[model samples]
Target chain A: MDGVHDIGGTDGLGPVGYRPEEPLFDNPWERTVFAMSFPAMASGLNLDAFRHGIEKMHPVDYLSSPYYEHWLFTMEKGLVETGLLTEEELRARTQQFLDDPSAPLPQRSDPAAAEAIVGFLRSGAPARREIDAKPAFAPGDRVLVRNLHPKGHTRLAGYLRGKRGVIDAVHGAFVFPDTHAHGLGEQPQHVYTVRFDSVEVWGPGADPRTVNHFDMWESYLVALDGDTDDRAALDR
Target chain B: MSTDHVLPVRPDYNADPTPDPVVVARVKALESLLLEKGVLASETVDRVADLYEKEVGPRNGARAVARAWTDPDFKQRLLADPVAACAELGIGGMQGEDMVVVENTDEVHNVIVCTLCSCYPWPVLGLPPNWYKYPAYRSRIVKDPRALLRGEFELDVPDEKTIKVWDSSAEVRYWVLPQQPPGTEGLSEEELVELITRDSMIGTGLPRTPDSPAGAR
Candidate 1:
């Protein structure tokens, strides 16, 4: 399930488009999608569900769609799958909007409910949670990112996979979104700041003094054996 | 949390700003359905959007940065435990959880990007700007920090100063405590907070000099 959303090291993405006067939301619909994400999650749709829904998008749709468009697509997918809204009902409503974009929505009956949802979104949800899981590695330990190409959700980028790096810091344990996204469980693990050399990631003729430090979960790494010693030496 | 092993050899990144009427209809439909079903209340969407758009923003991060600038003890605590420190100042939530504050010094310059996705410390700096999520900024920033900074933000780090790029690949978020501008020793914490622009904390730009035009943003 290698989704197209993971675009990291590949080049030719072009220049960063700078918007001098970028408004918070490009359009009114963007605001609705943005707002819906909060309550969708609050109503029991976890972060992973929302993210997984996006990953479920067809490559063409994902790439062609704009940022907020992606959100809207995934939000609808989650809502439909979770039984929050029937597909037929959603389609009918969509047709209504398509017929007239300015049509008013079926407003909330209770004002207090809106206030509570708003309050919840404003406070926000924190993913960090106390876990009994212990860290496998410590700072200064040299480890290699396991060459993994899982068919599901993962935080490990393709470029950094299989690369050796030193653990700069141990960031305690947190919810493992890879598993949590799939309704498995919060398989918490130790997350570390793994530092990789520019030369190692980009090849030689790169800045040796410079390095990339990334937060990597313990599951993505394996202790390097003597075989990796030569690469580690070159890294230094 | 996604991977791309079978993606096209060279997929083009096109950012279309124009809204798709079909998708807009779908979103509108979804909103109405959720509201009618009582799954979500009306104005809930507006409140969340407003919360990020107008309520929370870089000013929160500026306040934290300002407090750290003035109080060495607070700075130490901020670096040691960003969540606790930020929570102490009331800036801890969704994207802000497990914050890692990177300090900018004469020897080292720190910048952040989420190569896999745009993961930022939202409680502090609010939602990331569009540039942060764009393919160009995400890809180039990690590969060539010097060139990208100079070309995009007019930020030139001397060849001698080491550039460290932190990619927020995991949930842990990062924000830079940029080096305080020179000749601002007498400024109050509130003034310092005003000087801390969102870009400076992101390391794409720097704090404004006292004499350099007011309000760089």
Candidate 2:
């Protein structure tokens, strides 16, 4: 899905702002949204489900919405899907504040739960999964990214599709997100660091010496017979 | 060293104001319901917030950088397998499990960007900065990295040095091991850590010089 969130090489996004000293969260609400995301998943919402919910949003809404807003919207969607809350219930809650602006909402009964969430967040979870599979390509092999446009969730960025690169290193098997995102099994596959010349990606007049490397799953690549720089070789 | 190309005015990507009241209300409502249902406890939320706000951040990354500077074996381990090396220093987890530290050299300069999204080593560098996730950064830093480095960051890359931009497009996140600044040979590991800024690790800026005051950039 070519969503607005995939704004890698697109233009007109404006300048990169800088702050001398940045805060962890700019506001209290940002922290609130961040805190809810962990527990929402802890309560049964899968990480993929959460990501898909965000991807499901209208492009315009996604583009204009701030970062945390995306998280909040996804949290709401996940809760509704998990039978914890309904659209109307969420709407009513929003409307309640719209109507009075001073209403006291519910607070957590057990304050200790926040500690547990923090502990979990501090001791981060590793996404790498153990799997027994031979790597299709090894370091120094030439390969081309298959021109793929999967309608489902995928880590294959739009820019890297249909490009040629060299296998820099092989990072043993890890759960492939494309399959894992769809409730499809965690089909672990070898992940490789594919090194693509900046010219190979952006085309002529680009920096020839500059290389852009992407961590690609094995399923997204097809082996090239030999190292070739000709454009025609890549098309095949 | 000269190109006539004009750089666009960088936008204030951090312009998002104190979140809108309605957005606040919505999140507050969701929290209340989850709390009432016992699905999430407030204590956990508070703790997570505190962990990010105080316990974790760029300081962890500084320690890693400083250690690598002082110990050649650790630096080799960091460059070879960042996950295991970071673990030796107790800095591996979360988005950093598949970490790969790219070393910066005289002939080549390394910078990191996640064009698809903001995939950063949170456990090591803490949460990402606002600009790292901005659209302008995700777009310009790849196609015209030299421009972004010069125009926005004020760190000009010499024509002789090739800039290799690592777009973290997968589970693995990258952090730049900026070359240790010259003239700091006698500094202790703790002193070196103070010179390591978050921007240097991200490859947008160089590490702080010992003579310059902190946050001078």
Candidate 3:
């Protein structure tokens, strides 16, 4: 889905801010939200599904809220939507904390569970999966990024849509996020590093000395027959 | 180079000095609910935060970069199969399951970004910085990286050098293999490690020279 989160190539968002010694977390709440995300995942929320929840946020709120606030939104939404917790329960619990600053929250010491979650974080869940399918394109092949604008979740960035690029490298088949996010299936496919010259992507005026490369799944690309300017070639 | 362009100011660009109280309550509320419902133990949350704070981070990535600077074989391995190479130094996992380390040389420079989201190598460089996640960097870097690096980061690349911006739109995470600075041949791997700042690996900044103030032992 085209959302505010997909902010590549869009102009006038202002200068990038940098801090020489930025702390890991800006606020206490930020740390809590970050830490909770792992266990929330341990509680059966899919990573792609969690990302889509953030994508589903209202465009205005997505931009205004801080990063962790977005995570908090996803966690809350996932828990409720998955039937783990009710809306009233969450609202009442929030009110309790809001009303009493020193409210004693529930706690449990489960060292075994703690270690398991930390171990999982240490060794991440690898998205690469074995599929008995050959890669459609190989390195050095000229391909066109299919002009796809899916209303559902997708990894294809809007800026790269309908652009031309060359296959730089072929990564093994990985779980396709488009299907994984919707609980359809892994539907794994080969992911390639597609290289786009700056001029091709940003037009002739762009600095010819630069290039942008993106990791594109096989389905997002189409083989170009020859060096022709026919836009119709994309559909064929 | 493109300095004449007037960028729009986003009101929420900078984080507020004080966090919202309601937002604070909401997270605390969720934690309590998760615990009561047996979805998450408080210990698990604490352990996860501790791992990032104490165990994993830029130090791991710095060590890998420094090792490459000293060992040519390791550098080849890092360039060819970064995941396996980093694992030789015990620095592979999490968002770094499939890693690609691009080399920065005299003619070409490399930078990594996730235009769609903040996909960073957690076991290596740790979580991404605020600017890496914000809209300004995400939106402008891919379009005019030379301008963005020069204006915002204060690191100006010469016109002759080519900038390759890797937009990590998929699972394969990317990081920079910063060129070893001149006059650092005599330094030990440990000494070289001190010079590899997090931003250097991100391609926004260069590695520190041995005689520089920050690189001084």
True contacts kept of each: 0.62, 0.71, 0.77
Q: What ranges in model 3 sit over 4 Å off?
A: A227-230, B1-9, B12-15, B215-217
**Docking quality band of candidate 1, CAPRI definitions:** acceptable
TM-score of each: 0.91, 0.93, 0.96
List where candidate 1 sits over 4 angstroms from the true fold: A225-236, B1-18, B214-217
What C-alpha lDDT does candidate 1 achieve relative to the native structure? 0.79
**Real A-B contacts recovered, model 1:** 0.62
Q: How well is each residue in B73-178 modelled by candidate 2, as lDDT tens digits?
A: 9999889888888888877666776888999999989889988668888988888888887677888888878888899898988977999888887778899998
Write model 2 residue lDDT over A19-106, tens digit each, in one string: 7787878888888888788888888777766776777778777766667788899899878978889999889878887777777756
lDDT tens string, model 1, B55-97?
A: 7899999999999989999999999999889888877777876
TM-score of chain B for predicted candidate 1: 0.90
- Candidate 2: global Cα-lDDT? 0.81
Using TM-score as the measure, the top candidate is 3
The window of 10 residues in a row where model 3 chain B has the poorest summed lDDT is B4-13
Which residue pairs clash within candidate 2?
A15-B10, A15-B11, A111-B43, A113-B43, A113-B44, A114-B43, A114-B44, A114-B45, A115-B43, A115-B44
> 2 or 3: which has the higher lDDT?
3
Q: Measured by TM-score, how close is model 2 to the native structure?
A: 0.93
